[model samples]
Target chain A: MRLLKIIIKNYKLLDDNFSLEFIPKGRKNIEDKEFELNQIDDNLYTFATMAVIGKNASGKTTTLEALAIAYDILSNFKIKHSLNEIKNNNKTISLELYFYYNKYLYYYKTDLGYEPINDFVSFKNEELYNCFYYKSYSNDIFNLDKYSKIINNTVLPDDTSIIYTILNKITMRGLYYWSDFELSYDIDKIIEIYKTLDTNMLSVVVNLLDEHIKDIKRENNNKFMILYNDNTQEVKTKKELFSMLSSGTTKGLFLYIQIITAMLSGADVLVDEIEIHFQRTLIDNIINLFKDKSINKYHSTLIFSTHYPELLDLTSRTDNIIICKQNKKRIIVENMYDYNLRSDSIKSKKLYENYFNTAINYETLMNLKKELMQEIK
Target chain B: MKYLIMCEGPNEKAVVNLLLDNNLLIFNRNDLLGLDIYHARQLVPYLVNLINSYNCSNLKIIRIGDKFTDKLKIPESIKHIIDYKQILKCHTHPELEILLIIDKNLFDKFNKEKSKIKAKDFAKKHISLNGHLYDNTTQFWNDYFKNNIKNLVNDIKKCKKIGKNKKEEIYLADLLKK
Candidate 1:
């Protein structure tokens, strides 16, 4: 299943009626098969990679969290676990998600209400539409008459998604999400999951990030053998291994392993702060892995956020880049495609120059300088 | 409806902001396309993309510049979306400094020596307020016209009658409300 678009309202810090599209809106500049997939229809295509970029505390993490929540609701059918992770005073959140499954486009709309006292999320209203990809593309998919309303206001469990009822019978595709703060807790899980996959790529990733490491081998269930150029060390815990290996190697190993596994199974991977702990070239290599059609045959999507705007130069299309900005306490998300940049334009330059008003404030920086100088005096 | 008021330079931008701030212009801040005046000479692809991104059908492009010799051309990408008729050019010629010259009551003297000295150089030498000479900065223009907005409006109106062909060109005063 591939996500096409999402419209979120009253969700965390996101602006009301905030909408994001995963597909190219108007003209398709680059025709590379790896850049986009034509699984649904020849005329319709979905991006293989999408990036969210913004200043600090500008809701880049919140945007990713929201996407993760929507993904969880669609894939797991349980909002209870995801709701616990998000803290919002808003009484209700509304989501309208569009995805492609089994040659059919499914439009799912649900209004979820949060009860602060009970600490529970209940579905207030739900609606589902199943339509043909072509018909929905040519006409307004929201027009109920054009499509079949398979589910409407159906009563379900308070914590369960309405999609669970429709997709329960069939096996659904998988979605992998890695939050920025999940590294410490995910290290052990990454090891356990990595043990099942091929170790050749992990060795290559480790060698690329850290020259000291010769190889990393999983000895058994609990222990890992790190073969350094000078010596070898066997560690039972990830903490000991992390102490020996560079942070870049450990994080790169974790990220590369996930990317490889996701590619193998054609699962969508959403990563937050993709540039952290890794060099620019390594980040470029990770993005190139998804863009290379030969390796990523399943068209698995890689969506991530980054503080470095230079990394945006890797994306060929503007639509694949999402710019987040804060306005009056609401987070406004805009697609770079709407900004009408030339295909050959340097995206990083525009971002660094604050062309989109996403860069840090110069006045604030000067104020900090003054405050620091006064303290020094 | 969306109005994209594109200024030629920072000085023109400041003048537009002053008019908008004092509610002396026909279009308010809310009527602007991007909530800011643009300064690009041509319709840049980014600006065109912003216009195309909007779902609104009625969008007018207003170009505020000192010179209109070069025609404003919409890129081919958005030609189907934005028609040539939607674009309006409001010239501040012979130069934007003409505003400073007129505001200083030196237009008649500058006109006699116009062939010898340009309006910009003339303003730099002649136009000054409280012993501070005009430096052609946006801040200077804002300061010079902050209290004399009515005079600035009248100067724009007076300059509209000098040397310009009313049939072919639109002036800054045309953007002001009656």
Candidate 2:
């Protein structure tokens, strides 16, 4: 099911009064400064560019990790047990996800046992991060077990996207860009979205790799591995992420994976430290993966955090972006678009700082005006 | 009549061009730019973007050499490639297709002596390629493409993996030398 919306109550390392809103393109704005989840709808930004800006340890990684972990557990729980049992079905965690698949509304809540103890808190600790599905109040309006919207199978695997299941076209496309390298997946699960190729385009890609992959696999079974010095050495399946690639290479390929692999196979990624060790120009190159049209639409929505303000030009309204700032006692978030009051593509964040955070991005600086004047003159 | 294709090695590109030219598929100086294929991990995505940008509707993608079927543990969907298959499939090159020409001998080599080419030996061979790839990456593209001599094409109707994307990537570079 497509996760159109999610509302978080009292959670660890998060704002007690925090609720992140995902407003879909053309959907009514359901997000405000207040935190509440009364009516989740089709407009929530499930599949769009979502930027979470915050100070170091401002919960940017935590927020993403929580969501990633939740989804990872849920997708795996239906079949294989997770590495951590206690973490798998925790009773004290509270989270709720509101999503839509095939234009049908669905809500999944997990009572990870955060309920009775804290009188100040709601009722229980519940979570449903990777949990996305479609539900019909009337039951006659739509069917969750099987869908007819997308040409593919209606019933989706537990780990796939609820949106892909309902639409039966594409599913759980976790396009993750990392700001830090600490978080990433161990192995990639490839999926296909039956799209046509661009002729020489596929060959261009294959030309570069066809020979190398052959050599690597020829020496061994067709597995992903690393060739050490003189003897043979086999790496774990997910060697690319952990391998010692340059920051730019890692970032670039990760973005490429988010794009081509998204096209070749219907796989989503969980990237970490997207901006780490990357030059400004490299960072610019990496974001263009989203702009490319050949990518799978469902798998193209990326969820990552950044410390760079110049990267602001990559996104449009604040809806696609968020700023994580630390207030006196809690982490605060403000929309990059709404905070600036401008709806156009801007390098506003770059003007704010060599690094961009919401606090500095939205606020105007005197030096930038002087710089603008110098350029104008 | 202008089209460009990138391959990982001179031998791989030459094998395809030679076969194409021999079969009456005329290639001119302005018609294509042959890029020596490098790493599968990096090559595919870059070319896809280039194709999307140029807006070319008819382009021939010929990747040739050896089929290291053993190591190519790719999913069946991407396995076993054909010449110009990509160009044909995308309708970008409606009549065009993506063909991967590989050495038939290496298939047996990988099958027979796979253990001989220890992972470390394979890595060394990869590093030996550092000069070419590093020079290309560090140097400008125009200069890189210029200094690199065009590979000679010959006849190779017996090449293997003639219709797969994943297996096509394993073209045998040293096969011709052998």
Candidate 3:
């Protein structure tokens, strides 16, 4: 299943509406550009790469966290551990996600209210069909006609989501969402995927780095050894290299493994602060890989948040870059495609500069700096 | 009929929408496109590229902005662009048609009297044409579309064939002076 769009509302600094769109639509002037484009249908096309740009605390990370939380809710069939802690007071924290599973579109919306009591409400639609509809703590009111005719009138407690119970029955192994982490926890899985992939392709990626990683082999006791270019007899454990290698090398390794795992699993990946601890050139190469259709043959969608302007510069399509900004008391999220811009004349760098330096955003930065100073005192 | 009108910001976008609503400007389906850029400097390179992309003599590019003010700062990235008309009038692509519209009091920034200012001087100048100079762009839009739809239509009619010849610039200059 490929994730398309996510709408997050009233969560943390994201008190207002924040949405991310992975697909580009309604453009009559699409030409062959540098980036690889995936055809959704006759007219709609989307970029595999997505980058989020914003000032600090402007809800860049919050947007990714919302997706991670939604994924957790779908994967685990339960509420996230910190959902209550982050939800706005007395307001409904809602999340709406659209995904393409098989050849059908699935839309899922959830509303968690914190009024008299914390309650969960959900509505899901498969294409034109209603999959699941549940509200409040009602008994046996779960509607699943459009979802599955065979499972009608199933009694689900308010605490349990209808989708959660039926998710196992559905084809959900293809969904893969990752939160940005320094340590690569799925090292074993990464090694498995790495072993199956073409050795030449692995060499191409490994050679891109200065470390010149000849290969990564899994050893005993959850430790992996990296073979370097020295060729003489130098093998370093992953733990030993953690202290010797630059932060960029470590991040590049994790990013490579994450990309390989996502592609092999045919799952959408959500990463926050992707440009963190990575060199500019390495980040550019990673973006190029995402843009290359052959490399991402499975069309694994990538949604990442970053503050790096160079990363934004690498983006060619308007829909590929999502902008997050803090308004009066709310966060407004918009993509290049939202403007309905038809020409390549509207470059990403210009838009990034215009957004970051606009008077409203400038004032936001100034006020934020003042608050930081006050806290320091 | 194929034209692009890039507005400075949201207020100008409202002005364009108002013009379209009252039939001040005529469009054939997707023939018209509008963009809202925060800085006039940001529009320069885009205008340059548009001029080169579609070399059609019938293609018109209209860029509307507020009256050029003395205090406004231009970013260094587009410092070479110099004047707004510089983008409209590309040396390599003189056939590139463009209509540069500014608000009233355009002469105020240049320290020139409105009546004494000749459109020919502006033809050589690269300054941004001002929209409603004295009033804000939104108020000017309201006053024009709400009160004088006929005159707005006439100005737009004159604007349609504007970049085809230099005479339209003088005509527009005289009309804006009013």
In candidate 1 chain B, what residue range of length 10 has the lowest lDDT sum? Answer: B44-53
Q: What does candidate 3's lDDT look like per residue over A1-377, in tens digits?
A: 55666677777767555776666643423222213356544434556767777777676776677766666555555554435544444455776766554444456666655433554433332122233323221122222233433343666555445555445443222233334443556444445556667766666566665456675555654465666787633456655655655656555655676677667765556777876676655555556556554466767667788766655545445667677777886777767566666554435556554744322466777999999999999
Interface RMSD of 2: 14.1
**DockQ score, prediction 1:** 0.01
RMSD of each: 22.2, 20.5, 18.0
Which parts of model 1 have CA positions greater than 4 angstroms off?
A: A33-40, A87-89, A115-120, A135-145, A152-156, A169-179, A229-238, B1-178
| Candidate number that wins on DockQ, 1 or 3 | 3
After superposing candidate 3 on the true structure, give the runs of residues whose Cα lies further than 4 Å from its correct spot.
A28-36, A42-44, A74-92, A112-161, A164-204, A222-224, A234-238, A338-342, A346-349, A352-377, B1-178
TM-scores, all models, native as reference: 0.62, 0.44, 0.52
Q: Which candidate wins on TM-score?
A: 1
Ranked by TM-score, the better of candidates 2 and 3 is: 3
Docking class of 1: incorrect
| Residues A87-130 of candidate 1: C-alpha lDDT, one tens digit per residue | 46454788898877766778888887776776777766677888
Q: Extract clashing residue pairs from model 1.
A: none
